[model samples]
Target: MAIDPTSPPTSPPRDTPRLSTRDKLILFVLCAANFMVALDFSVLNVALPVLGADLGMSQSALQWAVTAFALPSGGFLLLFGRIGDLYGRRKLFLTGLVLFAAASLLATFAWDPASFLTGRALQGLGAAVIVPSGMSLLTTTFAEGPARDRALGISGTLMSLGFTIGVVAGGVLTDALGWRSTMGLLALFALIVLPLAPGLLPESRTPDRPHLDVPGAITVTGGLLSLIYALTTAADHGFGRADVVVTLIAGIALLTAFAVVESRTDAPLVSLSMLRRRTVAWGNLGGLITFSMMSTVVFVLTLYLQEILHLSAWETGLVFGVQGIMAVIAGSLTPRVVSRLGARRTLVAGLTGQGAFMIALLFLNEHSWSVWLAAVAVSLASMPHVAAIISYGLTVTSGVPDEEQGLATGLVTSTQQVGITIGIPLLGVLATTSDDLLSGTRLVMGIDAAILLVGAALIALGLRTWRSAGSGAVEAEPVGSR
Candidate 1:
């Protein structure tokens, strides 16, 4: 007879208030890798022009340097996430570190346009492996409740800070040491982590291993790849382009096929049944909305500050510095906040506050007073935005059993990646279409605010503290779901 892998993962015990040295080491290793990935995501942005000139990449080809990293990272998450569970998370994590380091080296030494894109795509592949594997390990290592919440809070904080810092670092590094130095930096981080991760991290797996669901994996991976490619492409070229339209259609068709395949498969790559869990369902939606809207806010503001307001890059960075500080503040406060409000209400309150502040940005323009207030509002919004960012991870991972932890986290991380990937494009197209850049930006912000508030309201009405089934889900009423 075989054991049900859904039962709690074997461990000494859980719920200890203080972490042992080993526990801290585990957290450090995992959180550091995630932080590096977050940093790498944006570190290339400011360095893109310098990098392109060195490699002779054209303006059209330049975006591919970024897109190359994004495609595989967004596409293969579901497949690799489940692979880690079926194989070994520790094995998968270590392999990811190795791949990441090697890919970084390749990008560092990249001599031509082709080589650079290949290296970036490989780096993206490595990142796809790292995120879900790291998340599943973290969730399983610490049992649910405060312990897991706190760990995720810290993890979330570092990731947020990494993105914020990466932008500034990209500019400074590009100017100081040249563009390749940015690539070298990530290689350094991965090299440092690769050797220690194997020894420090505990290995865990699904006790009852089932055959890999090839059909489900194929459809989902293809769908996501196509969809993400389309989104990234549309960001640069308008949606009217033939490639964008065709890819968009193909992506939708593939995903619909994936759903059908999953329903029919005996051992699906992702357990569709789990989506019924209120925690899983609402939680993922919340995660997607929070990340997308927040990232959109940042993107539009970057344009408004630099292009519209004609602020220097340094001044723009200064205005948004408040966000980085709040990310740190939330890390320390999240555990206490979640402990008191519970993940459900904490997410709602965080979203509500974040949305409110987003609305406050609508007043922003050339007026000195409005500009000052708008800057302050974004900083104030950062508190709840960071809170929402951390809490949503807790909400999604809360009651997921060990067996499905990888898949659960895979879905969660996919939302995180896709949310960030899509937010700019989805709203950016809107911003570009408007008659005036300022009004367009303000319009985009208003729409973003509405989306956030509406999402928060839905989660509030839909999620409950009380568990109806042994499963984390309940019959959530849809209140302005979108």
Candidate 2:
């Protein structure tokens, strides 16, 4: 049934409809697509040195290869979400998928740094559109129940799997088929998804969804791009360059203006009133901290493995693979844990475990066996951290109405990307300024520990409100109803 977007959703009647197999397949396809998008980002890291040599890219240019994708994916997520709502989600998702596939094809053949960077940016834009719209589709198709929980669980597992496998696959492809082939493979996958999508995926329900907020989108996108550009340049430019100063100042002013506009607009791209709620505010903030600290942890550990331990790129990636195993285990068991322990307690326990593990890592040295022991420590350490992040995500979206879910999902995604962006620069500074690499590694880990603790504290403090308001069952609700 087409949604009357201007009217709030009426409570469903007595008979809850069962989902068709087509619905399930559609969700699975979209999840797989999203997984590919996420995996390509990190998997490319292992192959960058090779790509840099091949294309004659300087460190700055190579960095842009990564940052270009990230900035667009993060910065325009809110804009894409609003677009999905205003237009039709299924239509936008399909459009994004086509664009993404085209970009991937272009990336596969690119011989120059400029072309590759452009392809990466386009791919990021595609992700920005596809992700939230795909999510919106899932919610509209599923009803509130066990079915939705299972679908979400599957989607989450696919994400974890993607992150785990992407690095390994990227390495294998780079070694055997070449870097271009890896990208070509993604294009093939996207093409496969596109044909199946039209028949399987559900259309957007919002018939009178608000109009596209063009000024809001442009201003916010420009502000985010400027901010990211400034920070990324600062890594090489020492933060003193005139361009950096100008970009930073302009970015701040534009973002400030965005906040003011959001407050005053009748149908804001992002509803400020939604943020005023304690759950949305605290939950997203905690998520931001969690992702930021996690990004730093990965950065520092990769450096430690490669620089100090003298491990090869493939070997370093292999070591990090243990975290993926741990994440998969945690993600798989999350539903059961939420059922048994409740969301609040589960989140608390996960944060506590992660923070403790990070603190213990501060004791390792160049000669110590603790470095080898790290594999086991990290495996255990990743569980709670991943679980807590998943838990907090569950909390934030529980309160969002379906029409605005795209916005909610976009906000979370944006927050995470922004966190990782900030974490890279801050932690990079700490690592570069230290006397030795090991001390720098320790400082980074210690800072990660502190950040996790703060995130934990926020989760703990927020638990009271969540428990009183109730948080879990809603997230576990059927995708159709969400």
Candidate 3:
């Protein structure tokens, strides 16, 4: 069927019913939840100095305030994803909201470093539960088609905007009302979302109530937690630190064990079969590369803007702020493009465009013109990210039964978090090892561009193989829907 540019993107299955007022409200709530999760990562960054002074924390200890949140957030995702599948998504999501809000309140009133860290850790746990559950809620509610694509597009946009908003808001809030204000804002957002969730969100779970794979959960969660810790630590201490080396090895061992356990377990936390699916496997690899490189791009640019060009914190925020706006615009338009081009091609275009933009940044310099150019490049880079995120989700969840939506959602979310956790250290190691900061930044950018280009090619080739195998019917159905 030819796509009608005048109408909303149509799904391949059939004409999906137009979204009702209630559906729109539900999308809003889910997107808000996702935005809250994404915002927490960057919002506290600007407040670190003030928070440290207030809590009597050392510079190194202050970094924990961030790491503390990240550890459990990334660690508990797979476990929670399966939990949501067996239990009820609504139940898990509501519990997460309450926990997040309470944690935020605790952080807001914290008088000591221990208290603050505890609150942050709890917030991470809440987020871990919320992200997978919320994503499952989204995928299950929006049928696999253009409607889902559009919904995912909005979700991707909010998530991208959340990070940028956090950067900007952290500076403004900390300056205006102190570091606690950032925590207070989170509390307020959580509180606002908590009450409406029960009414707006629908309950869902797998029909058979599959048995929880305890051993599988333990190995996978432990493995992921250990790996994230190593990456986080490596960002600060380098890859060679004794603890980092030990933890990385341990993470690998446990994950290897996890794969073994899953292959044997009747009710595995992750279905090894899902991993075998071309869309699920390659889409995730594409997502990992996209997130890892995008993060590094931002990290390098932050240093360039602040250290090399002497831009103030607020000025740096403004530069990236423009990029965020572009991301939102790109996200809004993506569903239409996907409707016309198909998800695989859309993903390829997005990845290719991102690489092109990153290559443009290799020429960046201390000149003011370069600053605007860098901003434009970053902005353009985000456009593809929006498409890739939405397409990847569709690719992973398409054809997946409702019972396993949580598992698919969990896998995608875990890949994203792990990608983010490793990006800084992975790229930072290269940049820091160079003779000069500029040289390192250029090298990293060049390498990232190459990786993205390669990823795009791989995805393109995978699509070609699928088409050649007489399985092109799968592509016509939806990116991932059977």
Candidate 4:
């Protein structure tokens, strides 16, 4: 007889505590690891031009540098999360850090584009494990209330700060030491995190879960890789190619099979029933849209800055510096905003603001050098989004027990990555199909606005569901939850 994977194994009763010295240390190590992960996400953007020159690659090949990391990380989240639950999160976290560091070293030494991409793909695999385990550790360490709130707040703030600073750091490194050194720095950081993990973090266990779902894991992972490759190929060669069509069909078929398998498995990787939870499903849907809008806009803007404005890599990075500063500020202020506005309202407002900013981009041009407009809009747009993301993360995590937090966080992260991966190609289609860059940008921006508005509407529906659920429940509500 098999056990139900949807039901997490029980541990001793949870003990939530104030920020102990150990808690702070755990936070420090995890944050360092997360910064390195987030750093890799945008760090390569600054180096793409230099890399293209060095490797004799085309625009399409350059995009793969980023996509290779994203697709695997997103696709394998459920698999890694389930593994974490079955084994131990601490073990997985340490393992992931080591793998990530090794991959970084490989990336630093690569002389060819293919070798470099292979390293990045490995880095993504490591991140798929690290991210969920880290989140689960944090969720388990801090119990509900002020302790959990502050821990999550600090974590969220540092992550946003990492995104802001990584670009600058990556640019400076690219200019001074070359693109390879950017990866080397990450390797060094990962090494520093290794020794600290042993004493700082506590191990978590789920002894009752079944063995890892190998069949489901392979199916989902293979499906996502195929789908992403097809989309990327479409961006470069158009969708008319037979290879693209075949890959796309195969990917869809495998994913459909994976879903069917999950329905019958005693210990499925991702419990489809969780999606039935209003908080989980709606939160993920909003995350997908918000991330898509953010990523699509940035994808188009990077090209505009480089091709149209002819800004140096460092200067282009500097242009985004203001938005980074704003993100830090917004991240720090998120808890307060969530407390005042409620999670649902905050999310809806954030989605609306982000949509408006993207729509406004339809008017930007080669004549528009007004950096302040972009900076201000980004800063303002970031505030609500940060607040909403952090709040919703807490809300969803709170709905589940500690052991499953890894799976929960992984699901959310995966959805966000999916948004990012799809954003470029989806918008690239609209942007590049036109004869002129400006026309393409406008068309893509309009699509982004529409998508964001749809997300905002979904959030609005979520708000109503949250209120209705709250009215019927007897438990004291979370501070940010209405």
Using TM-score as the measure, the top candidate is: 3
List runs of model 2 lying over 4 Å from the truth: 1-20, 144-146, 235-238, 467-471, 474-482
**Roughly what TM-score does model 2 have, to 2 decimal places?**
0.89
Candidate 2 lDDT tens digits, 344-442: 556667777887888877876776465576666666787886676665555566656778878877776677667767776777668766789889888
> lDDT of each structure?
0.83, 0.72, 0.85, 0.73
In order, what is each prediction's RMSD in angstroms? Answer: 5.4, 6.2, 3.7, 6.5
Better of 1 and 3 by TM-score: 3
On lDDT, the leading prediction is 3
10 residues in a row with least lDDT, candidate 1: 468-477
Candidate 3 on 51-130: residue-level lDDT in tens? 99989999889869988999999999999999999999999999999999999999999989999999999999999999
Question: Model 3: clashing residue pairs?
Answer: 398-480, 398-481, 399-481, 399-482
Stretches of model 3 off by over 4 angstroms after superposition: 1-17, 467-482
Error of 4 at 441 (Å): 1.7
Tens-digit lDDT track of model 4 for 1-482: 21221222232212233577877888888878877787778777778888888877788688788778877777777778778888999999999999999999988998888888899999999988888888888878777554665567667666655666777787999889998888899899899999899888898968576777788889988887778777767766777889789989988998998899889998777677765566677767777777767767766766677777777767767777777777777776665554444445556767887787776677767765645555565566666556656665665565576667777877777775676666776777777677888778778878888888887886676545353121111121232454
Give the TM-score ranking, best first.
3, 1, 2, 4
Report clash pairs, candidate 2.
141-480, 142-479, 142-480, 142-481, 143-480, 143-481, 144-478, 145-478, 148-478, 148-479
- Cα deviation in Å at residue 385, candidate 4? 2.6
Q: Give the TM-score of each candidate.
A: 0.92, 0.89, 0.94, 0.88
